[model samples]
Target: MEGKTCCVTGHRDLPQKEINHVKAALRREIDSAVADGFTRFMSGFADGVDQYFAEIVLEKKKTNPALELIAVIPYQKRLDSLMAKGRTYEMLEACADVVVMQEKCHPSVYSHRNRYMVEHSDRVIAVYDGREKGGTVRAIRFAHQFRKELREIPVGLILDKNRTNLGQNRI
Candidate 1:
């Protein structure tokens, strides 16, 4: 297998079960990348799957000194709303090479950050719930538009079984 840079993207509001599944999928993808001699990883540093991927890379780096984890932050200080930002920052501080999309926060900086990750990566690993909007959807669409190889993990199983109306309810 040939080495290649792997990028990760996913939904931010994933259920706990779905989050675990997505994390497992990302670990597999990262392991595959390593088997293929790829030691570099890039993550958007979002709350859910992005954080999971970054953590996995950080763990791998402890055992494999050659592996590199890059945190492609969408904007500086855009993480204020995320409860996991502190932990993500700690992980970034430990093992990641940080790349800020903008020196300051902007409304559309995340979109630009996603584009940058897709443009620079050899492939994308995405966890989506088949939504037509949101940052995850946009990132997947960007990957498709750019003709990048995508490994998708759909998280529809996370939705409540009793809930039929998705519009008024949260997944």
Candidate 2:
């Protein structure tokens, strides 16, 4: 429930072809954060990359029992909104060490959730496609404004020379 916390944010509709590569990059970023003494990971419990990030945190806890997974649920009906995104809603709720529910749900509930996470976290690990809009873009911008250490994985250009395949996935 304490120590350095990293919040996760990303798009819901990630391209299928980049799933593996993006996940790899996210895992690496998370591992590096752990090495830097991040003991807790926070997720919005949304679809796509948020779910993936939460899964990685849970998996990492198997080896590092001290690590914690926290779900920052925005409003009471947040799960209902997230339910369409596979079993992430149930999984995160069941596995999270701490689940913080907001007072109410509003039209801008997700924005509130993102703000809460960014405000509390010391760092942010976001999978962004650089589309110039959407919640992912907003979260990344918010993180920068809050001066949180950000590790952004460009899932859009999953095949770009500089970012793709980690150390080496050359053609």
Q: Residue by residue across 1-171, what tens digits does model 1's lDDT show?
A: 134788888887887667677778888888888887777789887777888898898888889988888878777675444325677558877754778789787778889999999988878888878778788888888899999999887677434432455755774
Reference-based TM-score of each model: 0.82, 0.82
Clashes of 1: 0
Clash count list over all predictions: 0, 0
Q: How accurate is candidate 1 locally (lDDT)?
A: 0.79
lDDT of 2 by residue, 1-171 (tens): 468988899888999988887788889988999999998888887768888888888888888888888888777666656655566756665564545456677778788789889988999988877777788888888898999999888766544645556557665
RMSD of 2: 4.1
| lDDT for residue 154 in candidate 2, whole number 0-100 | 75
